[model samples]
Target chain A: MEKFGTLTAIAAAYPKVNVDTDLIIRVERCAGTPREALGPWAFEMVRYRPDGSEDPGFVFNREPWREAKILVAGENFGTGSSREMAVWALARMGLRCVIAPSFGEIFFGNCLQNGLLAIRLPADEVRRLMALASAPASATFTVDLARQTINGTTRFEISPRPKRMLLEGLDELGLTLAMEPEIAAFQAMDRPRRPWIYL
Target chain B: MGRSLFEKLWDLHVIAELGDGMQLLHVDRHILNELSGSRAQLDNAKRSLKPRHPQLTLGVADHVVPTEPGRAGDKTPWAKNVMQIFRDESRRDGILLLDVNDPDQGIEHVIGPESGFTLPGTLLVCGDSHTCTNGALGALAWGIGSSEVCHVLATQTIVQPKPRSMRARFEGALPPGVTAKDLMLALIGKYGTTGALGHAVEYAGAAIRELEIEGRMTLCNLSIEFGAKIGMVAPDEKTYAYLKGRRHAPQGALWDQALAHWRTLPSDPDARFDREVALDCSGLVPQVTWGTSPEDVIGVDGRIPDLKPEALAYMGLSPGQPLAGTRIDRVFIGSCTNSRLSDLRAAAAIARGRRVAAHVEAWVVPGSMRVKREAEAEGLHEVFRAAGFQWREPGCSMCVGANGDLVGPGERCVSTSNRNFVGRQGPGARTHLASPATAAACAVAGEITDARTL
Candidate 1:
């Protein structure tokens, strides 16, 4: 995972509510594709035409937004499927941050795991961000993880653990393994109480 | 202040309180399927790490496995390869693999409870979102991402922030023909998909209590559809009976001990929830989704609301159009959500003595091989076949559309699966989510029709 600190880049606005994991990367794309290769297929359904040409009508295919590294989206973004490839696709497509009013619980976790900064803002704040990102001249926004602010103005709230994970790119598995003594002790006490659980 | 079921389950699983509202949770059961499991295993292998507790994990080859009869020869080389990898990895990691030919093989959520691997008061995690289906067994189960799968595999634990508790109490008994599927769809329709976000929702009251084990599973299956990662029903006599002699359930003295613990798993009286919503199901009718999102649903006889133009345009449906009577090109009656024996029986009852309409292509894919075998022994397969509905082997056939079972582009399908998101069935494929019986009715009528009318 890449460490996420502060990033300043072009942000695109896709304000469609309930943009699920299927829309982020269809199930078909996940069949055999490697994680790094999923970039081109991100939002493939709406991002391309039948002939495999770019759908110019899509915001990410237009002017400066074509180079966007951030996305300001509508409510309930990444709303379906526990497929972590959705987060991988967005990250592999160069999106470093996503600002939305709300997100699916699993998707939010997947984003943190992959170092993609997913920030939840008020609906009005998200709409304002979308408006600002819609105009090419005002599309550039800065997301600073260290200070937990967007554009050095709007502060965002993130839990301490995920915040630290994002800033340091800490491997969660390693962190948990470090607490092996605690885990073993808990199991020692729990095993006799619930003997059926241990196979 | 009594504790909610979620609080009790959380407390039981916590290994350590890693400050900041997060806790390292010890996973009691971790179920895995080919699509996600193979990747996680490969990632672990690449890191040269071994699973901390393979005995606690259960593997099933479901996703991407062909559901056609004689599927061993029918699978694409690519899919066959994926299954082989899953098989090889499960063996290498010492995890119990329910291979493609295993009699118990099925969708993880379906098989978990059926085989007794899922039990009351246990915290289970799977790589699929519909894992909440097992929550019906009075367990705290939810979906996890592939990375979390690797985490659980390597550490037998997951780090999670505590979630709030919410309760949806169905106050009245459901009328006939209105199944648990309808109860869930009606709830999602009434409250948008995000209604229960960041909360663990418990189904309570008359309707939920009256529902049988399979029906409860169907209700809990769609918890993910409504943005709740966890959904559960308190274990009762029905739950106990359902697990009494299943393959992996506790036995002998263990059974007695397990029962005593399970009896205490329900929420204590006067327990407070962070949120509460109540619905009167006495007047509720069958539900059918009309738009892309699961929340874009209406009662079978109700008109489509003028909402979400993109969803309307994608589904090729107009505002104020009655959901019923809309023509359908296909009917799919299987998925983790509703592929159990009861679901099959419900659909079979409707298919009895009636042929599928010539214009519609319909199929019945059971949830598990056990379900398939049980259905066949009961002659349900013959009933479906005689009615011109294809009786297929068990797997997630058309639900995810990854195993070469898909609705054609621009074709409208009535499915028993959970999600109806854009391109969920296939690119340009429009899906109307419904109960299995309702899907059978759509097949026989060549259009969306209420199961009760038949």
Candidate 2:
């Protein structure tokens, strides 16, 4: 488990808007069992076709994004459906961060839990990064999680909430469990007041 | 920056800032169901805590409960556990509990608006993402986490930052064969899901005005699919007329005051938005998910995408596929998303006296007991049963896999509920999203086809 508010990583740009969880993690590949789906089937829904062949036209299928750490995307990235598989798939695909103009509600939550940093950047800024990534084969960008900034040879920074949970790899349950000491104190202090809640 | 529905409600309700970015904002209403019982309510009970705003909280047992009239709980241990917990906890908190046998019991999202608990120009919160259904009534609503639920129970509020505002104006009459469900599916196909993220979405235009309260609610319910947590339509004469005599709608002098406030809730006529998308209702068709996701959709007559290598690698799908004529073994014509009276009517209209195809197995699940009774009175249930479709009790069966209604592996189905993500129906089951009418036609044809052509 690791937590860093800000860390610089090489960027990968996916400019298509409204990319869904099905594409992020395919249900077919992730099928077999709950535990198996956790690792591979995350985006099985969107990534594969009926005949079980790959759609080469997909943005992530392209060479530029195949192995990049940061995915800079267009408006509404990760929209539609509430499956957490999308987040798990992207994270498992070795994506550490995703910088988009926006994100779907469920996808955003799943991303935070599965440890994929979903960054909401401005449309203009998103386009700027897309241009930089498409400019040269070797072109790259840097993402700073602590400051919520995306910078590269193209310098641009945007500040949003610096929620420390994702950086520290603590999900909702993790955060609640992390407060054990404080919760224990609160419970121990007033056992007589609320007997039904505690043993 | 543009703020989405989440931003508007967050800004309006934020009362104080705590350590870090954690800020507390008022929670006007709290909605809960049986599915979230263990992680949320039961967990909260361990603290011997009481809701800070019991008056604002309401719990209903819908998910994981048998919809049969005499059935107190589902036949399964997992479902029974949660239903019992929901009942006991609501009694303990003195909050309103709509039990499975109670006439009020139904999908929380559907019942909220019908009971007028979710009205125009109010802030609403629930543990379900589709909680955005309140937006149809001109309220700002979104889903919260279990911890957030606990926080709201304890403090009457949860932390918030802000969101950008966006407006999606859908104009023109949605021509015949299209519905709010179809329109929302189209929007997701176009906007790519995250289109409304971190922003409040105000759905306006001629088409929006023409929709019924339930239809409007269905549209708002899918806001989360486009990355927006809150989706609202401003209250108007239509809104006023629908609420005239609802169980909890304002009455007496309170009615006038509520209308006065609702009249001002819409964004200014010329108000600027951070992002804007305009949709034309003239050319849309019946929507259906061809693959494993909602956005992996095609029209009734369309074909699947010419996928790429990366997509194939990610999903194990092949390119150059025809979505049409795909064999389907099942049709589920109900769920919280589209199991209203209209949905039943649409499906029944086709199923009436028409036998389902030899191989097509179908189930028509009502969203609630109220819908079931209504359909029964109208003979919709009889039509389904006659057509060889299973007429089951109300609950969210086949929508989520908590119930015993899992679509068999390697089988294909047409479902009316939202979300076409993989395994959502069952392991290795391929679910194609469609409206109820379309689902019925598929059941009759035993393959992917159009309702109009039926």
Candidate 3:
């Protein structure tokens, strides 16, 4: 997993709300392809034409924005589908962070697990960022995980464990094993209490 | 203080609080499917982490399996490999696997309940988001990521923060012809997709209680679409009766004990939730999506919503345009959300004497092989076939655009699946989500139409 500390990159603005996983990466695109090949197909529906030509007018395909490593999207970004391939597609597409007013629960979890920063800010701040992102001259934004701030526009909130995980590059496997003793103790007591569940 | 079901379920499974609201929660049951589980992950973990409780876990092959018989199975190398991986790993790990030919094979959510692997008052986790479908039985179930899957396989536990609780209480009765899918879409339409973000939602009140176990599952299955990881319904006599005599359910004396425990799973009268919303389903009508998101829905009789320019362009809809006469190119009636016997029966009834329109391609993929066999025994297959709908094998087919089943580019489809997001059915395909009956009606009409009118 990539350790996320700080990132400074051009941000692209996509103001469409409910940018679901299906829009991010189609199920068929993710089905048989290698994870690495998913980047080019990210947002393929809007990004390309039926003839496979790029849609020059789409936000991600526009100048400066095409090189953007940060995405400022509308609220409820990443709703629908639990496929982590959505996050993989974004990260593989060179996006290190996604800023939105809100996000789907599973998508938020997937972002953190895959070492991508998902920042939630006030709607006003998101709108402001969206404007800045759309204007190429002010498209650059910096995300500082240590300070829990984005472009110094707002103090973001991320749970401490996730913050630590991002900083240290620790995955859940190691952390879960650290609590094995406690898990065993709970199971010992729970087994007899819910015997029917075991069978 | 009285406890809500969420509180009770969370407190019961917490192994340790890792600070910052995170906890190591024991997973009583973990389910794996081809979409989420892979041979590579399991093979890598085997070097250090053997499945601690193989008996508590089961493997399901659903995602990439061919829903049609005798096709090159290798249509997509990626899918074929993943399916093989699931089979190889499950056998090596000594985990019970329901392969394509297995009579018990089906979508994980459907098989979980029908096979009795999902029980009330236990915690269940799967790698797919719709794992919440199992929560209808009063179980505390939610979807987890692959890393969490590996953790559960190694320790039978997952580390996570407990989510805040929210409840949507549905008052009044749904009008005839409206199903759980309609109620869910209506709720999503009202609240938007992010309405339940960061919280576990409990479906309660008169309307929820009135639903049968299958209906309840359909409601919870789409909870993920509403941005909630968990969607639950407290168990009742309906739940108990549904689970009785299932292969994995407790028998006789054990059943009695289980029943006694389940009776205590509902939220106490005075229990509190962090958030609450009430939706009255008094006159709710069948719903269909006009835009990509599930939240972008309207009643069948209503006009397309005034959505943003981008959505309108993508969906090929104009503001206030009547949604009824929109042409449809395909109709899909399968997915964990609405592929059960009742769903099939509802669609079959609509297609009993009608024929699919020449311009429309229609398919009915049953939720499970068991469901397929039963539907065939009842001659449901003949109804669909007689109406020009292809009756296929049990699995996630057009729902996820896998298994070589896909809607052509720029084609319009009315689907019973949970999502209608861009490219969900295929690249450049426009999907409008509806209930099985509505989809069946659309197939016959060659356009989006109200099932009630038929």
Model 2 has an lDDT value of 0.69
- Among the numbered candidates, top TM-score falls to 1
User: Which of the two candidates, 1 or 2, achieves a greater lDDT against the reference?
Assistant: 1
lDDT of 1 by residue, A1-71 (tens): 78998899999999999999989998866767888899999999999999999999999888998889999
Residues A1-199 of candidate 3 have per-residue lDDT tens digits of: 8899889999999988888888888776666667888899898878988788999979888888889999999889988777888888999999999999998878888898888999898898899989989898999888999999888756899888899999988887777777777877887787788778665
Docking class of 1: high
| Candidate 2 lDDT over residue span B308-373, tens digit each | 343333334456655557788899988778888888898898888899999888988888778888
Q: How does model 3 score on DockQ?
A: 0.71
Give each model a TM-score. Answer: 0.99, 0.75, 0.96
Best by DockQ: 1
| Better by DockQ, candidate 2 or 1 | 1
Candidate 2's docking class is: incorrect
Give per-model CA RMSD: 0.9, 7.8, 1.9
**Error at B98, model 2, angstroms:** 1.7
lDDT-better candidate, 2 vs 3? 3
Candidate 1 Cα misplacement greater than 4 A, ranges: B72-75
lDDT of 1 by residue, B219-315 (tens): 9999998899999999999999999999889999999999999999899998999999988999998999999999998899999888888899999
Which candidate has the top score in lDDT? 1
Given candidate 3, what's the lDDT at residue A98? 94
lDDT of residue B15 for candidate 3: 83
**Candidate 3 deviates by what RMSD?**
1.9
How many steric clashes between backbone atoms does each model show? 0, 59, 0
